[model samples]
Target: MGEHAAVAAVDDPVTVDRIAANLRELGVEAGDTLLVHTSLSELGWVAGGPQAVVDALQRVVTADGTLVMPTHSTQYSDPSVWSNPPVPDDWIPQIRESMPPFRPELTPSRGMGAVAECFRDYPETVRSRHPLYSFAAWGADAESIVADHSFENAMGEASPLARVYDRDGSVLLLGADHASNTSLHLAEYRADLDTGRVTETAPVLRDDERTMVEWTDIEHDSGDFPQVGAAFEKAHPEAVRQDDVGTATAKLVDQPALVDFGAEWMSDHR
Candidate 1:
């Protein structure tokens, strides 16, 4: 949505304090480890935009809590897998060779939105090492949540998703649906499905030098995520808390329950 339209849609400016209050009402508590997925535009006109949203999250969660968000840089992956405006076949090798290595501190996340991009650069925020599916985190356990992000199985056991699961974290979907719920990928890893592996290459910094590394990992698909989420919500309605944060619909989910249910659901159906 455009700026003028967004401004016209809201009766009052959505301030940081307002967003924080909305988040608190949505079950976000102090010291809770939360993984957030948000749409800045969906929240309508705001007094401070993405930064205000981030600030509100921090205010609710506090420094004792942990905050996480996907900072994926799919553009750093193999050009062969590129379909959204795919490059020429001859240019693949050239792009790979010339592409800068993924630097957690420098490489900007692609398609992760303004809020995430801002969160990544926030003070004390640390990002994982996965070139394609890195996650940025802040507050307590920030380093541990993003630590040891394996090159293979970027969203599986060794990934930050698992760390969040270990911490009994919750997921906050601000104007995003189950399709954007990345925790389901952890279920895909555990579910009894033949998610075949694909060999992918990415440029990484090795001893402060650029080097191309290859790994094989399960090919993730989100086509069934929305359906799985709907079923889960139906089966466990009480676990999914729905409310309004700003002008956008928000949902606070129990991560472990959803992942457990998702694993069983995908195993039986898919």
Candidate 2:
């Protein structure tokens, strides 16, 4: 939505304090490890825009709590799988060979929205090493959550998703649905679904030079995530707390519970 339309959509500008208050009311607390997915535009007009949202989260979660966001750089992946405005096949080889290495301090998150992109620049925020499925984190548990991200099991047990699961984290969806809830991908790995592995390639920094690396990762799908999320929410209402923050609808979920329920749901339904 455009600025004017966004401003007109809400009665008051969404400020950091207001966002933080709403978050607290939605059950966010200090020292909680939280995974957040947000849509800035969905929050209507804001006084400080994306930064305000980030600040509000930080304010509520505090330094003792960890804040995490998916900072995936999908452009670094094999160009052969590009479907949103797919490139010509002739350009694939050139793209792969010339693609820049995944630099944790520099590479921007593709399609992860403005809030996450802004959060990436925050002081002391560290990102994982997974080329395509990296996650950015800040606060007390940042390093642990982002440590040792396995390239082959990007969203599986070796990934930050598992670390968050270990920490008993919460998932906050701000103007985003369960479809954008990446935690479910972790469940996919735990589920009975024998989703085969797919060969993937990414440019990485090795000995101060960019080189292409290949690995096999489990084939994960989100086609059924919405169904699984709906079923889980319906069956376990106490596990999810839904409310509104600014003009956008928000959901605070128990990450481990959601994953467990999602794994069971997928196993029985898929």
Candidate 3:
């Protein structure tokens, strides 16, 4: 069956209360800082859709807890490297010149899904300033977490993922898998596994002028994230918890534990 057909087969509308309850069952607490990676469709047609999912997360985390999601604008990067439906070589300069500067309020997420897009639209959310690797956060500690995302190390020790790791936060995989677990990128940095570096350029609004800037950042590779995650689960089963949120499977894992295990695993395996 096709993806939409499978979803239609379930057709059960999930509500805010139900989502919140399921989150609680997945080990989310009242004052937890959660980095969520979600697939809205897997939640079985939420009543209010992405907004309802965001509300449910907020309800569970409450005002004291912080919520975070990757709002990366990958399209903001250099057009010269575009591969999927790549523009003609002659158009690279034109595209770069015309590319709009990254705006926290207006720049839309490319592939982060409906839930993250909705969360980014949240009025109280604070987004990182990085043009390509921005992250949106809300609630307590949000500002401190996303305030300084280093352009040179987008997912390294200088990024929001580092703060989440240092704060002993949790990762909530709501119908998403290890591939979407961005925290793993931190382990790649920690492992110092020679993932290489890539020089990327983007347009940014600086002093009311759109300026094109270039920076060399560590090339983050998630090719083995699934394998690493499987190894992590095997090594630290106690730190990982699983449950259901709506019809979607949910995983709650200790960020620090995963990173620690992942660093070690990558060092030995990668």
Per-candidate local distance difference test: 0.94, 0.93, 0.89
Candidate 3 per-residue C-alpha lDDT over 217-257 given as tens digits, one digit per residue, 9 for 90 to 100? 87778999999898888888999999988888899999999
lDDT of predicted model 3 = 0.89
> How do all the candidates rank in terms of TM-score, highest first?
1, 2, 3
TM-score head-to-head 1 vs 3, winner: 1
Q: What is the C-alpha lDDT profile of model 2 across 1-270, one tens digit per residue?
A: 789989999988989999999999999999999999999999999999999999999999999999999999998877788899899999998998788899998999999999999999999999999899999999999999999999887999999999999999999999999999999999999999868889998888989988778889888899988898898899989999998999999999999999999998889888
- TM for candidate 2 is 0.98
Clashing pairs in 3: none
**Deviation in Å, model 3, residue 180 alpha carbon:** 1.1
Tens-place lDDT per residue, model 1, 8-105, is: 98999999999999999999999999999999999989899999999999999999999999999999877886899988999998998899999999
Residue pair clashes in candidate 1: none
Best by lDDT, which number? Answer: 1
Cα RMSD to the true fold for all candidates: 0.7, 0.9, 1.5
Candidate 2 global CA lDDT score: 0.93
Candidate 1 vs 3: which has more lDDT = 1
